[model samples]
Target: MEVKKKLLDLVRDKIRFKHYSYSTERTYIHWIKHYILFHHKKHPIEMGKIEIELYLTKLATNDRVAPTTQNQAFSALLFLYKEVLGLDISEWNIQALRAQERKHIPVVLTKEEVREVLQNIPSEYSLLVHLMYGCGLRMSEALNLRVKDIDFGFDKIYVWDSKSLKDRTIPLPQKLKAKLLEQVESVKLLHKQDLKDGYGNVFIPYALEKKYPRSKLEAKWQYLFPMKSISTDPRTKEKRRHHVMAQTLGRNIKVASQKANLNKRVTSHIFRHSYATHLLQAGIDLRSIQELLGHKSVETTMIYTHVVSEMNKAKVISPLDF
Candidate 1:
């Protein structure tokens, strides 16, 4: 029991050392625990490529986990072996039965449908929805937005260390300027109150906290969309004002979709999909769209082309019409 506890502690230490997000740290810990329990709590140092392959194969064959989920599990184990345990995994070529990957078109809301849903969304999340669709931002990107990231003078919004681990800028939506400024002013006031009450520090990303020691207390470092109440930092256990939880926005989106009377399923990501599809429909070139969406490959951006083609099919003259 002591050995198992120490092993997980090492993984957590390494993860924090690398400055991974709290959510990522949690995911890695969960997968690592499951992997150990799957092997009857054998220490990972005693295992190698064959044990890794067997566990992954069981997930696909017996548990039937999705491809992405299986891949996440593989990543956790790989991190444990390489980073935490100081093992070289360069030649571990053991192949496991891979989960079958299925490609499906993402659900997108039409411009009118998007407007209807936005109208139904509670005022609290309205600005967030607008930004998500206007900038084609992922939910995390939107939620994690910092005051410094919004470049009002330059008319750009900087996205730092996104899912691709790359930074990119988006054109600030002209329609949202007033609301955004208002939100900034509101944050400034709230941050003042928090500081006066002796709890105003925000969570700084990566190694910035160590480098710029005073940044945590700066207004510019605060989350753009903060929660109504202060919450304790999961890692530091410090009382800090973090951003609104993803689940809060997620549940409200479901309720807003129902109120809007939309026939299709609605999700936060659907707004992003709609943003890409609408741009394609508006004659925006795929290459430019790829840059705006921060896609690593044009091939990934090409999915929007397929979506547009499917929509265009409805305009074709049928045999009866001819």
Candidate 2:
């Protein structure tokens, strides 16, 4: 696993060129692994640019990966060539063999459908789903939520080091405020229990730990959804808690969706899509939604507008007709 280890380190180093979240770090690493495997485990240092191009071309034509996936592959390769191996990779204008995505709308759940889905979910998982819908949060954001981030008076949740490694705050739903307050009490109990047993210090990013040193014990630094117990931080060798895994939540939602008699392929992101669409449907402004979702560009928010327009399907008429 030497290559795997180096590959992981390479990914971390490469991400520093352009700031990306730990989530993106994980995703980039996965694609790099797949790319290496596709070439029958040939090392990137051994392969020339032409081989890299051909491999990517093969992925587009033969493997037929989706456009987003293909783009991610391109980015990973670009990073490998430009940063890791010191090679020039320029002008990727390649296209996937399949047609571009056009006029496609994201699958959205109705209010009743969302309610039923929540009802069908086992009680343990319901609160998480509520947070996802009630606040326009990506599942990872919800998973990484810490107890201190909840602001009961302001009805807001702080999201730090999100997908872009940038921090933003999204409002807490007024309806869910009561439940969140209760959850806060629950996290306090867990923290106290950890103290009594001598499970000292909290897990934070390796660099942050060295910088703040004492933040680990701070009440605000505790994970809103803390891990079951402290584990040795692989990077620092100190015991700390980390966020819950997204895959765990994904599996739980998948099984619950099936049991709820829903047929859609319900990944954790489907809830995020539903979040945007439902908010737009409820007469929330696009700019407001964009801010809440932490979108850097308004263009990203425009997609939800398309979803609503597609749903309405009203006919156009001349002024005379009016």
> What TM-score would every model get versus the actual structure?
0.97, 0.82
Tens digits of per-residue lDDT, candidate 1, 1-322, equal 8999998999999999988878889999999999999999998889898889999999999999999999999999889988998886756886999999999888888899999999998998899888999999999999999999999999999999898877999999999998999999999999999999999999886578779999999999999999999998878899999998999999999999999999999999999899999999998999999989889999999998888888889789999988
Clashing pairs in 2: 146-224, 147-224, 203-240, 203-241
True-vs-predicted CA distance for residue 112, candidate 1, Å: 1.2
Which candidate number maximizes lDDT?
1
Task: Please provide, for model 2 over 1-322, each residue's C-alpha lDDT reduced to its tens digit, 9 standing for 90 to 100.
Answer: 6886786687687785455565677777787788788778888778766666676777777877776777788787777777777777675444434424456577777777787787876666678888887777888789878787888878778998776556888877888888878777877788877777876467666677779998887767777776666777544476656656677777888888787788777777777888899889989998998888888888988898887887777555658998
Residue pairs that clash (backbone atoms under 3 angstroms), model 1 = none
Report lDDT per candidate: 0.92, 0.76
lDDT of 2: 0.76
Error of 1 at 182 (Å): 0.7
Instruction: Using TM-score, give the best candidate's number.
Output: 1
